[model samples]
Target: MKVAIIHDWLVSYGGAEKVLEEQLALFPQADIYTLLHKLGSQSPLIESKQIRTSGLQRLPIGDHRKLIALMPYAAEQFDLTSYDLVLSNTFAIVHGVISTPDQLHMAYVNRTMRYAWDTYHQDLAAFGVGGGIKRLAASLGYHYLRLWDLAAFQRPDLVLANSPFSAQRLQKYYHREAQILFAPVDTEQFAPAETRDDYYVTVGRLVPLKGIDLMVKAFTTSGRRLIVIGDGPQLDELRAMAGPNIEFTGKLSSPQVAEILSRARGYLAMAEEDFGIANVEALASGTPVIAWGQGGVRHTVQHGKNGWLFAKRSSESLNAAVEQFERLDWLSPQLIAQSAQQFSGAAYRASLRQQINSALQRREQEN
Candidate 1:
């Protein structure tokens, strides 16, 4: 089959891109289509693919990262009927691909669009597009994007959601039920260490939604040493505001991150994540997680067993959970590592192949 892998964008390496990489492995002959392609910065797996980008690629912008903000407008440019099978890894607008009776379209969604309508005002203000004509333009943009996003859901033959939280969102937003397949974890690369170092660690893009500020505040009040790895727009401001006990390591190589995770006393995750791969990485490295008991973290973490989950996202709640983590002596490193095995790469690959085969069989039956 001639598979066409559709992605929102290829500007940065993140969870959705990781999923796309895995999909490429499954369909080695597949061609990739995206709104923009920022080559060289991504995993070598993507760089090797036969990638096709939207008309946005013709723009004179030196940095492809800037094109993400323009994706709402770019969705109208994709033509999806040429391929036999269409597999979309959508976090944003690639699901807008139009399909025909002859082709099968499947979408792997990370989450529903968080900024299209519900957070439209916040996003507009963040971009300095406020009041008068800017407000009018933002309103038009939001309405157009929302309709496009909603209409896009109908084109897919099947939808696979990355988490239960995402599945719930799919039902609520689009009235579509989706198959839940948790994102893959590289368990082999994150093996448990015999001994752990004394610091707590947090790794992710340092953004507002990531709740890195909350983790920093909780770690400060708990009097525990903390190390933060990763960088984003908030990094400089956060680093300047952090206390003496907190250290910002910025971005590091995957091996460097694994070494840090393996030696850490515990992992601190504050986000209400859709599905946190880093949380599993921590468990695979034999480090327990102290996280907010919200969103997909509820599914990934077992409180006081593999990790401790705070009931609230507040610093006080997280600090209280830190104390609880200190008191708990029952979590064996072996058990923590074993808990992570369920989300291993091998398991993910097997499950995904089974799903693909089933999808193909169903299509054949329809014919």
Candidate 2:
């Protein structure tokens, strides 16, 4: 089979990139088509592939807002006629890649664009784009993008959702059904440490959507130690808002993050993730995850079992959960790590392979 893989962009190595790496392993000979690529920014497996970039790659990198307007047009430009099967791994527009009726095009989508939909108002507020002319212009712009996003979401022959949370949104916004294919974590890299640490850790981009501010407020209120890992636009702001108890690591190597996670007293997650891969990685490292009980983390973090879940998205609720988590002494780190085995890379690949096999067999029979 002449396979091709379409990915949104290769700026950072996160859950989507991990899934793309697995897709590369699954289809070693497949050519890669992406909107942009920060060459050598990915795992060796991805770097070794034949990468083809869109015209937008010429612009400044990192999924910038200026680029979003052009993405749908750029994505539609990928010539996929020769390929028998095309797999698009995206959190963005590559799912719109054009394909022939004779071809099989499937997309492993991790999220529905929040800026254009559910979190539109919140995102506008975060960016300081608001009321009067600014809001109207921004809303008008995203309104058109949302229209295109809806149409692009339906272009794929099959849609694979990264988590049940995302699957529901795909169904609700786009009126499309998606098979849930949980994103994976590299359990081998995130093994438990010999000893636990006193400080709690939170890992993810520093963004309003990530609820880092909420974590900062809670930890600051209690004067508890919090190690914030990863960086983004909110880094400086979060640092300014944080008390002495909160420490920002900016960004770290994967091994470094794993080392930190393995020894942490627990992982703090406030965002309602589509799948929460970092939470699973923390769990794999034998660290309990204290998260807001919403989205996909609810599926992983059981209240008072592996970790505690705050009922609300507020700092007060998170603070209460943290206090409650400290009193619980029975949750075993080893058991928590074992439960995360289901999200390991090997298991993800196996399940995805089976799903693809069934699709291919059916296609062959139809032909």
Candidate 3:
């Protein structure tokens, strides 16, 4: 089949990009289409693809964030008429692409653009740019984006979700039901170590939604050590708020991240993630997680079994959970790693093939 993969942007490597990478692995012949492509910004495997970017790429501005307003237009402008199948890996606007009646368009939606819906104001405030005329412009832009986002859902033949949590969001926000497909976890790449380090670890973009501040606060009050890996907008702010026991490693190589996860006392996850891949990585390392009790972690983590889930999203709740975590028995690393193996790349490839076959069969029947 002549397949084309649509992604929102290729400016950075992230969870959605990771999913896109897996999709590329499944359909090596598929051409990649994105709103913007910053060369050398992602994995060499993705960089090796026949990547095609939209007009957004030509913008003189280095920041992709400023181009959000033009994304819907850019997304719709991608020409996919020649392709037999169009697979979209959407976190933002890529799902809005115009598809022909003859093509089967399948979407793997990680998030339904929470900024345009659930966390609209919070995002504005977090970015510290939503004031006066800027706020008014953002509000109007997101409003239009919302309208376009709703219409975009109608183009896809089938929609798949990265997690059950994402499926729920797809239903709630887009008014569309999506089949659940867990994101691929490189279980083989993250193996358990015989011994663990004394400190807790958390790996991800240091952003407001990640609740890094909450983790830092909780760990600070408890006087337990925390090692935070990764960098983002809130890095400096989080670093300022963190106490002596907390350490920031900025960003590290994949092997370094794996080694830290393998040796850490437990992985601390504070985000209401679509699917906490880092949690799976931790489990693969035979480490448990202390996660906020919401989103995809509810499915990945078995409370009091594989990991502990705080009842609330606050630091107090997380602190209490930490206190309780100190009293729990150490889980078997082999068993924890075994559980995470179910989300391995092999499983994703099989499930993706099944979904594709089913989608193709459905299209044939319709014709």
Candidate 4:
């Protein structure tokens, strides 16, 4: 098969990039297309691919920062007609890539554009873009993008949702059904350790969307040691707000993160993620999670079994859950690790291969 993979942008090696890496492994011959790329910013596995960037790559705004307006148009310009199958690992505009009627276009969506939908107000508030000419401009831009986004949703032959949290939104917003395929965790790479540590750990982008502020406030009140192991635009602000009890590790290698997870008392998930990959990674390391009881966490975390889930999205709610968690007996490390196996790389590969083959067969029958 002549396969092609389209990604929103290759800025950093985050969750979406991890999924792209797996897709590359599955289709080694596939040429990759993206809106922009920051060389050496992602894994070597991704950097080595035959990646082609769009016209937006030349923009002065590095990595497409503050330039969402042109993404849909830029993405639609990719000429993917030569390929038989196009697999898009998109969190942004790459889903709108133009495909010939003969080509199969499938998108693995993390979630619909949050800046244009559910988290619109929250994003604006977080970025201090509320009520002004700036807000008016942002509103108009998002309004245009929302229209484009909705139309783009129909272009893909199949939409694969990373979690039910994402699938529900796709159904609600686009009136489209997506095949559920949870993003994989490399279980083999993260081994369980019997020994544990007193300090809790949380790993993800240190951003407003991640609710790092909530975690800092909760841990400050509880006086619990929290080791945050990631860095982003919100790094400086988050560091300033964090108490002495919180230790910011900036960023770490995968091995370092796995080692930290293996030794952590538990992983704290403050964000309402579409798919909480870190929660599963924590389970893989035999570390239980203390997550906000919403979004993807509800699907992964089994309250009082694998880990504790706080009811509300506030610091007070998280603090109460921490107190309750301290009262519980020690959990079985083996069971927690076993729970993560279902979302392993092997499982994702099998499911993805089956789905792609089925889709191909259906196309053949139709032709």
lDDT of candidate model 4 versus the reference: 0.88
TM-score for all predictions? 0.93, 0.96, 0.96, 0.97
Query: What global local distance difference test value does model 3 have?
Result: 0.88
State, as a TM-score between 0 and 1, how close model 3 is to the true structure: 0.96
Model 1 C-alpha lDDT per residue in residues 222-245, reported as the tens digit of each score: 778999999988998887778899
After superposition, the stretches of candidate 2 with alpha carbons farther than 4 Å from their true spots are: 60-63
TM-score of 2: 0.96
Which scores better on TM-score, 1 or 3? 3
Runs in model 1 lying further than 4 Å from the true structure = 62-73, 117-133
State the C-alpha lDDT per candidate: 0.83, 0.87, 0.88, 0.88
Query: How many collisions per candidate?
Result: 0, 0, 0, 0
User: Which stretches in model 3 have alpha-carbon errors above 4 Å?
Assistant: 129-132
Q: For candidate 2, write residues 260-334 as lDDT tens digits.
A: 999999899988889899999999999999999889998877778888888789999988988888888845778
Off by over 4 Å in 4: none
Q: Rank the candidates by TM-score, best first.
A: 4, 3, 2, 1
Cα lDDT of model 2 overall? 0.87
